[model samples]
Target: MALIILAHPNFDKSFANKTIIEALENSKLDLEIRNIHDLYPDFKINAKAEQEALLRHQTIVFQYPFYWYSMPAILKQWFDIVFEYQFAYGSKGDKLKNKNFVPSFTVGSSESSYTALGFQHFRVYEFCKHLEQTAYHTQMNYIDPIYFHGTSLAAGYTPDSIMTNAKHHAQKLIATLSQLQ
Candidate 1:
């Protein structure tokens, strides 16, 4: 089964992330979705429960919006709490070893803005070093990330267009999940 850690702060107000999630719900794959914001609105993450969930699944998917070139604050907090030293890295911390790590996200900026010559000044994958290293540290397989750029209204993407793109992203993600199975 696949476990999706959804970390959107404003889920109700989301366009792309919400659509993608809806699609995934309809995909019928064996999935356990944990919407961290809703699950821990007080930011009090239950490490034991989270770790238990992790142990139940082979594929771990981090689904969110790309915020400040990283994940939402809640996810970072979850990682800090759930991925404890002796639980994720040190000796006797092999519970997560060999799990699949997949990052699925939506970006507000256009793809061109992520280039060296563009405003962001780095490629998308260049920004994923932290994630890649996290997978390595946990002995997890780092699958290539699935992302959709130009998802913001400010970037001139209409709701319909974003939804269409989100559906496509969901299909691609579903396929990836199937491959894992």
Candidate 2:
């Protein structure tokens, strides 16, 4: 099964991420979804519960909107606290070994912005290298992420276009999970 840890601070304000999550729920996939922001409103992460959740699933997904070219503050906090020395790393931290890590995120900027000559000056995967390294250090398989770009300035996308993209996102996610199994 896949465990998706949604970390959007302002989930209601997101059009792309909201639609993508809805599509995932409608799909018949063996997965659990946890909106961390809703669960930990006070920014206090339940480390024991979170670590237990990670242990129950083979594929772990961090789904959220790209904020300032990185994950949301809440998710960062979760990583800082959840991935502790004795649990996720260090000598006895083999809990996450052989697990899969998939990061599904939405980028507000257009795809062109993530280029050598573009404003961001790097590809999406380049920005996500930290995540890959984390997976490696923890002995997990870091699958390439599913990305949805241009949400902030998606002027050309109609309602039908948006829904179509969301459906595609869900399909891709399901396929990714199945392959991992």
Candidate 3:
């Protein structure tokens, strides 16, 4: 089974992320989802429980909205707390070894703006090095991430369009999970 760690800070106000999660919920995939923000609103993470969940699944998927070229602060905090020494890394940290690590995120900017000659002046994949290195440090197989750009309402995107795209993203994610199984 796969474990999806949803790290949206303001989930109730989300469009793309919410739609994608809804689509996944409606699917028949054998997966578990942890809405971390809801689980730890006070920012108090249960490291033991998280480690146990990691042990139960062969694949771990991080679902969130890209913020400031990285993950939301809560997700970063989750990593800091949950992925502790002797558990996710270090001598006895083989607990997450051999598991598949996948990052699935939604970007508020357009894809075109993420190129070298574009506004962001860097490719999207470049931002994933941190995550890739995290997977490497923990001895997990880092799969290519799944992401959708142009998801912000401020980017002139309608809620319906975002919802439709999110559904497609969910379908692709479901297929990927099926193949992993």
Candidate 4:
């Protein structure tokens, strides 16, 4: 089973990420999703609890809206504290060995805009290096990320569009989990 980690800082204010989470909650993906904003509103993460959750699953999917080419702040903090010595890295640390780490995110800009010749001046993979490298360090198989781009000005985007894409993304995420399993 895959554990979908929800890390949107303001999920209530979000149109894309929120719908995606809702879709996963309704699906049968064997998901153990944790909303960072709700779980650690004050940023005090339960280390033991988080680690135990990690132990229970073989795949980890970080679902968040791309912020400044990375994940939301709380997720980065989760990585810093949760993935520590003797637990996620080093000779004794192998909690994530052979596990899959997939990053599924929403980007306001178009995929093309994340290229060298594009506005962002960096490829999506290049921007996601940190996530991939972290997975590598912990011996996790980094999977190709799923991205929803150009949604801000996607034209005709409405509540229906949000729900449709959310369900679609959720199904795709589940498909990826099935492959890993």
Candidate 5:
């Protein structure tokens, strides 16, 4: 099973994230949704409960929007609090070992804009290097990320295009989970 930890500050107003969430909701796979903003509007996180949730799943998916080239404030806080030294690292931190860490996100800019010659000046992988390193430190497998670019202020995109990507997003995630060794 994969646990999707979604953190979107303005979830209600999101078109791309919402579409993907709906697709996941309608899928048949074993999934657990944790909308952090809805769960802890005050930024209060229950570490123990979150740890227990991680222990139950073999895969952990952090789904969110790209905020200032990184994750939202609440999600970053979740990482700081939930992935404790004794639990996610250090000599005794083996609880997360062998698990998979997958990051699913939506980027506002075009995919090409993330290249070296483009505005972002780096690839998506470079942007998410911290996440990959976190997974490595925790002894977990860092799976390929799932991201949909040109999702925000999509000047040239239509509603149908978004929906199509949403449907494909869900399918790809399920496929990735199934292919995991």
Candidate 6:
């Protein structure tokens, strides 16, 4: 199975991510989509359960709607609590050593604005560095992220079109997962 850690706090309001996740959860992708906020409303993650969830899958995806240049707080806690030192980074932390970690995110703006000359003044990668580093520390293979950059700015962001793109992304991910397998 592929562990999909979904961290969209405003999932209900997201026209894009919601469609994406819904397709992922209901499809034949061998996925487990965990809504961080719904699982731990008080910011309390069950370490044992979280670790087990990680161990159960070969590929892990940190799926979220980008917020203020970072992920949601619940995802931060998910990392802190689930990715323990001894199990994920320490000398004995070989559980995730060869696993594949993918960070899938959606942005509210267009792709052009993420360039150095754009209004954001930084590349899309600058915001994703922390996640890359985190995966490296755990010895996981960090794949290039799956991004829907202009969803919010896209025309209407209708369910049909968003779902279409999401299905394509998921299919691409499935191919990537096959390579890892």
Model 2 misplacement above 4 A: 153-160
Position 162, candidate 2: lDDT: 55
TM-score per candidate, in order? Answer: 0.98, 0.94, 0.98, 0.91, 0.94, 0.88
lDDT of 1 by residue, 111-162 (tens): 9999999999998889899999999998889999999898899878999999
Candidate 5 lDDT over residue span 77-148, tens digit each: 999999999999999999999999999888887889999999989988888889889999999999988887
Which window of ten consecutive residues has the lowest lDDT sum in model 2?
153-162
Sequence-dependent TM-score of model 4: 0.91
Model 1 residue 169 CA deviation in Å: 0.6
User: What is the per-residue lDDT of model 6 for residues 1-181, given as tens digits with 9 covering 90 to 100?
Assistant: 7888888887887777777777676666677878888898898899888888889999998888787888888888889898997899898988898889998887777778888889888978888899889989999998988776666645345566666776776666667765665
Error of 1 at 27 (Å): 0.8
Angstrom error of the Cα, residue 91, model 4: value is 1.8
Model 1, residue 44: distance off in Å is: 0.8
Q: Comparing 3 and 4 by TM-score, which wins?
A: 3
Query: Count of backbone clashes for each model?
Result: 0, 0, 0, 0, 0, 0
Q: Locate the minimum summed-lDDT window of 10 residues in model 1.
A: 86-95
Off by over 4 Å in 1: none
Every candidate's lDDT: 0.94, 0.87, 0.94, 0.84, 0.87, 0.81
Which prediction has more favorable lDDT, 1 or 5? Answer: 1
* Error in Å for residue 121 of model 1: 0.7
Candidate 4 lDDT, tens digit per residue, 78-166? 99889999999998999889988999998877777888899999988888888888999999999989877755635445666666676
Better of 2 and 6 by lDDT: 2
What's the residue-level lDDT of 21 in candidate 5? 85
